[model samples]
Target: MPVTSVTTDTEALTLTVVADFPVPVERLWGAFADPRKLERFWGPPGYPATFDRYELRPGGIAHYWMTSPEGERFYGRWDFSEIEEPDRIVVLDSFADAEGEIDTSVPSGRMTLLFESTATGSRLTAVSESPTLEALEQVLAMGQAEGMREAFGQLDVVLAELREYALGKGTVTEVLDDTHVRITRAFEAPRHLLWRAHTEPELMRKWLLGPGGWEMTACENDFVVGGSYRNAWAPVGDTVGEPFGFDGENLVIDPERRIVTTERMTGAPFPANVNDLSFDEDGGITLLTLIISFPDVAQRDMVLATGMTTGMEASYQRLESEILASV
Candidate 1:
């Protein structure tokens, strides 16, 4: 099988794929309708697939397991709306749990596949529909179009070879919102060391700032509500001309439990945003939570769009490295 044509309507966020296969219509329909057959040709090349329950009828559902080469496993389910033998299949597909429960929190959509007999062989067309334009754009930006193209191309090859046991995980989700993420990690060091890493200006600078081009010019911590702390980072090296600063008000501080709260400016001219850092000690491991609350979804999105998670992870790694060095 070869893809004869591919067209996508941006406004509608709908993709259409037309492929010509050397097989007959019945074979093409079986490739999609039969669980075992479908799994053999599903997902991209090098990815394997497994089917749990596959019911090919209206109101029925099919659950699939896809495992990536990297050992990442993802589950997906398809709710059948129409199943016309040797002709068509319409379904609502989405990410699902192992038990085939759909994850409503994530974006998913409906799709319809049509199979027709041609003089040469068979023709197949697939159309997908998203709930919203934003969701559609998000999927497109996430590289789903290219991924689907690659996966379908692999399907063609598997069908040609009549291969068995196709494997691969479903789509990968990119964090597009801050609210959808929560940071939780444990530190092997004691609570006192963790507290010093977070609080003491000298240790903070060593781990939190590292050798970044910017230097922490001012850091005052009254450690109480109405108190203030400010840090100014002026670029060094090639970034010498860049200027950045962060100022915040300490809203809460409980040193006994190692909890702190602050309203910090995000280098923007806007008012400070709320941030809460909580620490818990379990035996010797120090569990920490850094929660940054925003005024609205827009602000949250703004912070997430800046890759805050990556930055936070890097800072934590540096902190851990410094702590290990101190011991």
Candidate 2:
């Protein structure tokens, strides 16, 4: 949750994102100045970026592309207009074609990134200004805000030189806002096996159990787009808890990379929550990120108050200790 706030101003025709990191201004600036470091977090989870060309000086241009899980490449270019070392950078961002040519069909915008010192570490303020309000709205509708948040969330991994940032952290939950919550966990397992642990009923039954007192009674899954899945659990032996389950429909499935689903409690009297889950792997370690969008603030708060994060941590720990260890 590096991003503190993401706001839009229709009158100003701008979208702004402010994030704080636990590193010095120079360290934070270097992440963007270096193409290699920037590639690690330039795109949202599951969409990794590759920089073909990078020039950090004023009037220089950068060419990059992000590859989707489906192997689709989306290109982008940045024309640097200003560069003030460790302080500010201004660029014209544009959509590009395969040949790195700007695609004027879609609107391009001017972006300004400001780096400043904070008591804890440093702060980054990024503003993208569109020429028209319609252009701003179009970008927002394309999930720009959520994409920016997810991209920034990956910075912690890149900034940690020792690569021990999330090692043994169990599970971390961040409340992004009134209706959105992001959960992250890392495991010493390959991405494909981690995907299998989630898609295969047999593997899921082994570790999806929340706490020690409960056991998964049934596990059913249709791991494909537009497919349905249901999972149930009940207390074991003398444990005093009723059976509970969740049912969801898969909205998008990107094989071992990502999954988006609409989930709801078995008999809850509320709207479904949209869950966007993504997996990113480095070496043999896999990072699992789940962003849940609740119907409203009340529903979000209710779920959190139920010790949801604690229960998830227990399940994730079991996953690592039992399933991952065996692998």
Candidate 3:
């Protein structure tokens, strides 16, 4: 099952495979450098790979074997030529024998993967070249293009699992002072970018979507301390649920450093809560602390028992992949 388009051009002597992921480029690029990540998605669908030896650098080689559905093994090798971090990689792809030797009887492909940052997501273009047009055709006839498409589809699974905890979550939900429920997450983007994502309306609408088949219909924000903000969302199509709304008044605004706001839900049984977002910077990274405070212990416990943490983590994931990555 090809995830996207796999195009071949004999005139240009190249086979190009393209995929667009909502995640950041760094997340996609990590797959090539880490052997474990590489093994997760290098093979076509229904065939999982196991790495025999992996050395991802200039003049190094990656040797792996993909186990077929019927337990058969297909060995492959990548002889690296150039290694660029988070942007490009050049490898000589070939079939390998049982002992990891290149099978010279088959054609080899000089593949170049270029990762381009798009306005909404990241686009990956993989071009495989050959010494001659005949050699390129030889590999094309061997199903290289289709194999790549399937492999890219599997790559989607790997990225999804990784992005679920995009910041490598600390895994500890702190209950500070027994009133403020604080959830801290480290993001790969800058603090200013993270701030902009939360403060700006258009960017906020993309990631703050509540549940599936729901869309944010209105987002109004007044960043000043005495100002107010209102955001409304409704289910799309024939979704069977009532619309949700969040109306809050800004209590504190400290630019990228901190923000405190009160939230009142116009639907459901949840009580009003005050949210404080504090952003910290570490080089190009951002550490955000989100504290949601309720009126009393019963309210906090009720919210926690309702599995709010899981939903919060999921929303943070979208914020990182969709909003910050695009920025």
Candidate 4:
């Protein structure tokens, strides 16, 4: 079986897996709604699953154990907070002790699972939220995103075996400027809405920064050409920590049209890192184009080496959630 391809925001540690299966919406919902069916394909590939208790209702809890091929065992639990039947499942997932108690010391997050019926089939989206950006980074480093992707790939196979499954198809494409990678995704929301989420401090704090152990420190944006913007991120941990900061030079700010900014590492000040965001409306849906340009090929390589893709993906997911909530 081919491993399901996964994408992550290198900075935010967000993971997104998109796959289209041949199963109908109702059948797909059945697989997700029925605990018995869920256990059959919930764990990563090659990991056997056993459920201790499963109550799929609002405020219910699902506790299960997964044993790897090497005979290693681990426990995980999901506390369901909201269940919208065939549409959405909202829960808080975490590592748990044998007694099914959440391990508070470990990082965990709230996840919202969305199922949208499409012309071909159902479009399923799972978005997980962490308390802090560092928490997101930690989980990504632990291979959570890849593990989830593998598990979803397993689901694809299980669904296929049950019938003729049509695998979800998508591409991993990037927009670049000879050096840096800039990924772009357009949604049906207005440009002003998107801009508010990107610029407003209160709105930015929610999905822009990670968990508790971090602070924005400082953020200033002129929102005009020849103006400047600075965003500072600092670790909230006690011991020595690394601080990440970005300073930008605004080249364009066309409300409802586009905003272009050139960013650079605050203290280090590498060459220019440009981001151009444009918006267009099609019927009732809005299109957002994000173009990020780096100084040179070497700088682009350096940025990639930092693993920004997964973090950025997570940031985008958070942004999506905020956007949906606002609308």
Task: Specify the highest-TM-score model's number.
Answer: 2
lDDT of 3 by residue, 108-152 (tens): 878899987777667788999887898988887878887888788
Could you tell me every candidate's TM-score relative to the true structure? 0.48, 0.70, 0.49, 0.47
Best by lDDT: 2
Q: What's model 3's TM-score?
A: 0.49
Worst 10 residues of 1 by lDDT: 162-171
lDDT of each: 0.65, 0.86, 0.76, 0.67
| Model 3 clashing residue pairs (backbone) | none
* Lowest-sum lDDT 10-residue window in model 3: 162-171
Which of candidates 2 and 3 reaches a greater TM-score?
A: 2
lDDT (tens digit, per residue) of candidate 4 on 1-327: 333246666565456666566567676777777665676568764354667788889989989877543345688889999988788888898989888999887788888887777787666677777778888887787778877776666565445432112211211236334654535454555657877777777777767764445667877888667888998888876835688889978776556655678888888957877776655443334445455667788888787778666665566666777654577
Candidate structures ordered by lDDT, highest first? 2, 3, 4, 1
Residue 265 in model 1: lDDT: 59
TM-score of 2: 0.70
**Which clashing pairs does model 2 show?**
none
lDDT of 2 by residue, 1-327 (tens): 789999999999988999999999999999999886797789986576779899999989999998753456899999999999999999999999988899998899999999999999999999999999889988899888888888988787777642376768878998877888889888878889999988888888988988788999878877777789998999988899989999989877867877778889999898999887877776567878888888899999989999998999988888888898888
Better of 2 and 4 by TM-score: 2
Q: Identify the runs in model 3 with alpha carbons over 4 angstroms from their true place.
A: 1-3, 162-327
Q: Each model's RMSD to truth, in Å?
A: 15.5, 5.3, 18.7, 22.1
lDDT digits (tens) for residues 156-251 of candidate 1: 533552112111211122332454333555666676778777788887776665345656666667766567777666666786455656777765
